[model samples]
Target: TILLGITKASLATDSFLSAASFQETARVLTDAAIEGKQDSLAGLKENVIIGKLIPAATGLPRYRQLTVAVEGYKAREVDELDIAAS
Candidate 1:
């Protein structure tokens, strides 16, 4: 398994919003804007950042139904993800 420091791992996340909010705020946001990146808010951090409820099913067995906002969320994917920069 590859070992990555927490900061490194967070920085490497696919969601630019999560990365920008976590650390290196300016750089991450700048890079994301330049690249026209879109955040899917698929992870816990991303949801927390947007004040959205966590999906019931994140495919991680350990986190089943942690704080699901919508019932039956597992049946369909969220069509929209909030990507507002903080």
Candidate 2:
């Protein structure tokens, strides 16, 4: 049936996306290890392996970016900046 075919296609697409995500994460971790840099961003597996907080249902401090407040400066809206042409 057409419905079954659609379901199969959806499952295959989900599997492919999952595999690609895993591959990318693995590549990043490998590169970090080679460079002797510690990946402080903890995820499920990493937290479990290190026996720390799993970043869920915890009162941990969230990551924040340091921003500087500029005065008397008008920022231009650049919604269509093309980097490829530069």
Model 2's alpha-carbon lDDT is 0.43
Per-residue CA lDDT of candidate 2, range 17-72, in tens? 32224445565556556767654544554554545555654314341222345798
Q: How many backbone clashes does every candidate have?
A: 0, 0
- C-alpha lDDT (0 to 100) for residue 33 of candidate 1: 91
Give me the displacement of residue 17 in model 1, in angstroms: 1.5
Off by over 4 Å in 2: 1-32, 59-86
State in Å the error of residue 63, model 1: 16
State the lDDT of candidate 1 residue by residue for 1-86, as single tens digits: 88899999989888998888878999999999999999987877787777775654543445533454667566543322322221
- What overall lDDT goes with each candidate model? 0.72, 0.43
User: In model 1, which residue pairs have backbone atoms overlapping below 3 Å?
Assistant: none
**Alpha-carbon RMSD, each predicted model:** 9.3, 16.0
**lDDT of residue 57 for candidate 1:** 54
